[model samples]
Target: MTILLTVLGIALFAFGLLFSIAWHELGHLSTAKLFGIRVPQYMVGFGPTIWSRVRGETEYGIKAIPAGGYIRMIGMFPPGEDGRLEARSTSPWRGMIEDARSAAFEELRPGDEDRLFYTRKPWKRVIVMFAGPFMNLVLAVAIFLGVAMTYGFATQTTEVAGVQKCVIAQSENRDNCAAGDPVSPARAAGLKAGDRITAFDGRPVKDWATLSDRIRDTIGPATLTVVRDGKEQVLHATLAKNMVARKDADGEVVPGKFVPAGYLGFAAKTEIVPLSLGASVDRMGDMIQNGVESVIAIPQKVPDLWNAAFGDGERKADSPVGVVGAARISGEVMNLDQPTTNLVAMFLMLLAGFNLSLFLFNMLPLLPLDGGHIAGALWESLRRNIAKVFRRPDPGPFDVAKLMPVAYVVAGLFIGFTLLVLVADIVNPVRIT
Candidate 1:
């Protein structure tokens, strides 16, 4: 039964990812069509066409690769030898220059000059190029808002419901707590389960963040104030170095033991923030921004994120994941017996976050990306205006073909990074508990 559920979940996740990719491409296709740009092919995925059909001068189909999709607009870049301008009867030099100009435009079909993408104004071109990433961003916002409305936002509160009996600590020596070892500080301080922590180190804790900040800043020993069974007590405890196996964000492992300095063997109490409609929207926006920032910082701060997550720095290569990982996680979520609404809410948030990352990553201004095209269009527009001011001929559109080498480098890096993440995901799959 679990296996079946897992399979189902995986399938659903793959479908969702594919749908998202298709939706992103659709944004470009629709906008281009709206602006009267000719779209010859609307393909989901890359490589050779797996299934396709010609309809009204467009070949709409699915490709073999399921990674991403694209709309082939005539005149996406400057013209080449095979472009329309080259076929015209003209001098060799004139033909060469016109060919370059034509290649700059996405191509229209033979005798279909009316539908050419290059015929559109620069602003319209910009709109068509921006639509894909814009659609992804919109999808993220909607997903986040939906999840927030359904589950409410998890908020930290000062009221603690439980204390840790055994905590994981970092140590090269044998004295550190191992797996299943009882947390020494809480035990030594006579703390028990169901204790309500009210303060730490003489500071009134209003939330987990405040308590954690205070605890982490304090080194050596500290006093823990807790209320148990209607009685308040102050217990002395010594902070120990924390160590455990963990992975960094780039999926690298940094193995070592370090002290957390001031530490408390306890978990935070979580409450739902009841948000008004406007507040919910605002909160969702904030969440989206934070999500984007985290994705951007992943390469640099992955180690810290891994340490925070697993408690030990053991960077592994397979920590990053692709669609396969998403499918696996979704499958696990679906297979849960009597899954709570909160669990589903968490999954939804995860999806939203993943989508947000996808949106941001694709927006990076590099070749073959939506942002690259947008950048190219903007640069061309700027160049054209500057040229006109100087009474010089337009340099035509930015030549994407000229960026082929750079694009290859980017593609190679992407593939390499992707493979590394895939390995990490397979070796150490992240499980939501």
Candidate 2:
């Protein structure tokens, strides 16, 4: 049964991935068509076509490999200087440039002269290129907000789960209470397990973090409103100062670091609960920040990923996860010892994370990615505006084809990194369990 569940999970994830890829390409296709740029093919994968049909001017198809997708826009690059599409290359680097230029014009139709992508205004070109990654971002935001505001997420609530028997400094790290220790403020206030805190010091507490922060910053008499047995009750207690684990701005405790703060002496209850729209947006912002940080940290993680794959280093939980690794985790999530709703939520969150990763990854301003083209357009627009202001001759469209050699190198490095990640994923897969 577990094996079947795992296989089922993998299949579901593969379908979701294909849908995501297609959705990404759809953005480019729609925007290109809207701008009257001829797109000859709208393919949802790489390699040989598995299924295809001619639809108007475009051949919409699914390919054998479900790795990625593309929309082949006609005349993606302007003609070379000297008013010609043909190229004569005497060097290898020039060959790369010519090859790229030739491919960009390979599907050029007669009427495509005016409809070429480069003929469009720079800002329009930017929108056409930016649309793909923007679609992914939209999908990610929708999925994240939907899951958060509907199915909700696992969170620590203001409800009390357990009360400390006595005051103990975090540095002590012992469960047993010492005779010299004072009674916990929670115990003295008669706060018990299952008591749901509604307010602190007359201020309504909507979440655990707020209540925790309020407690940490206050060390005197305070009022706590609790709901026990469906009845609201207020209790007054004098909070104590103690050395507790220091928390960062995000309210996460800093490991191995303690600071003097107000002590509440009780652990918050953890449960899956829905968030308000405001809270969901706040969470989305945090995810975006974390995603950006993760992208920035990729270069540093390569060494660790290589060691984990080829050497005997243990696979860390924070290790980068490739498609294979993520699918495996989805399978594990399906087989987890949890309720069906929870499992579904986990799967959806996995899909959301994948979409978010896709958005971040493609937005990198490097060749072959959407952001690179957008950057080129922006640069072209800037240069053209400066020339117009100076009453100088138009410099014309920036020949992005000239950067093919650099693009090739970037592509090679990306391929190498992807393969390394693949090896690491298979050898030392990051597991949920």
Q: Scored by CA lDDT, what does every candidate get?
A: 0.69, 0.91
Per-residue lDDT of candidate 1, residues 317-401 (tens digit): 3345567666777877886664477657766766776677777887888876777767777888899999999999977766555
User: Please, what are the lDDT tens digits per residue for candidate 2 over residues 128-175?
Assistant: 988888888888899899999998988999999999989999998999
* Decoy 1 TM-score against native: 0.67
Clashes of each: 35, 0
Determine which window of 10 residues in candidate 1 has minimal summed lDDT.
244-253
Query: Which candidate leads the pack in TM-score?
Result: 2
